[model samples]
Target: MSVPKPIEFRGSALDDLRAFPLAARREAGHQIDRVQHGQEPDDWKPMATVGQGVKEIRIRDAAGAFRVIYVAKFADAVYVLHCFKKKTEKTSKADLDLAAKRYRDLVKELAQ
Candidate 1:
């Protein structure tokens, strides 16, 4: 696939990937594949406003209920923002923070 014109990011999205091991990063590409194809889990939700025209997607991975946030419908590709292994119950506030941070960074980089 081709890279999108622009990608969105926030702290959470960055942290998710940052926290992952090298293997997880490789595996994340597969998950992104499913996301672009509308195969994300049923629990997924949008993270709302990010950049001037960017949108964030949050989803619960069916395999491990991990919380994943990323930018979708990004031109020709979906950029995986972040992925976090769940913590038993709902996702914690930290997750959101990271997502927000990623968003800011992306917006700044793109001057959005």
Candidate 2:
């Protein structure tokens, strides 16, 4: 079996996570660790392609629903593109745009 890639969070994604309540943040961290270790949590779902490969980790707790967008296509790492509290049934265009932009930036950075 292949080894799992390390997970790296973008500055903006980290900032978003920092704003989460303690419980949600802790759960998200655990889920991310699972992904890093090659286990795809049952709650995770693939996002429609915008540019680079992206998937969403869905977390719902007493604090409410939270979403984490990440790309795992890189050879050496999984890049967390965005994290935010999901306030509606549908994801906002602004959030999608931000995550897509971050994914694109990470792809360019990896190529260099």
Candidate 3:
């Protein structure tokens, strides 16, 4: 079987991420860069699952842990979907549902 596709985050999400402060952006940048290099990068914490086609990249700050869902669209590009802070040990089913829904929406939009 062929390798699975990586979803990409374009448009607003890209703009938002690009607008993050240098430090925060750098953190994401470093992690994402590893992905570009064919690594499944993880930080100090384990990742939370948002859905089948969606996986959340976990990050932490003074506020605690949060997640960002990025879609691998190509060998070198990943499109981040949504970013939100986590309050529980496990990823909420609601978050996964939202990610799954958004993933479908993104796929449908990108196909055109």
Candidate 4:
């Protein structure tokens, strides 16, 4: 079998990750690594059908719950579309919209 791709973070996603506390950020990093190696962590969850091909890595700790949204398309890369601390039981529309937009942009970019 082929090897899995490495994870690449978008600007906004990187910024969101940096905003998380140290422990949370470390946890998120570990989960991303798992994805990079083609191993889905237990906390991973698929997003809605509207955001097809996207999955969120759930990170819950004493601090709070955080999410990292990403899509693995090409054999060489996993694109991180969004990262944020979830404030409610469900993801906010704004966040989903942003991720969708970014996902589109990335697809377009790769097409060229």
For model 1, the superposed segments whose C-alpha errors exceed 4 Å read 1-28, 36-43, 49-63
Which residue pairs collide in model 4, if any? none
RMSD of 4: 1.8
- By the lDDT metric, which is better: model 1 or model 4? 4
Clashes of 1: 10
Predicted candidate 1 versus true structure: per-residue lDDT over 78-107, tens digit per residue: 555556876667567776566667657654
lDDT of each: 0.54, 0.85, 0.60, 0.85
Instruction: Give the C-alpha miss distance for residue 4 in model 1, angstroms.
Output: 8.4
Q: Residue 62's C-alpha lDDT in candidate 1?
A: 42
Q: Model 3 TM-score?
A: 0.60
Candidate 2 wrong stretches, greater than 4 Å: 1-4
User: Candidate 2: lDDT of 40?
Assistant: 88
Cα displacement (angstroms), candidate 3, residue 13, comes to 4.2
**RMSD (CA, angstroms), candidate 2:** 1.8
Per-residue alpha-carbon lDDT of model 3 for 35-94, expressed as tens digits?
A: 655566586332335433445566776646656677664344565666555779977877
lDDT of 3: 0.60
Expressed as tens digits, the lDDT of each residue in 50-70 for candidate 4 is 266789889998888999999
lDDT of 1 at 52: 36
TM-score of each: 0.54, 0.89, 0.60, 0.89
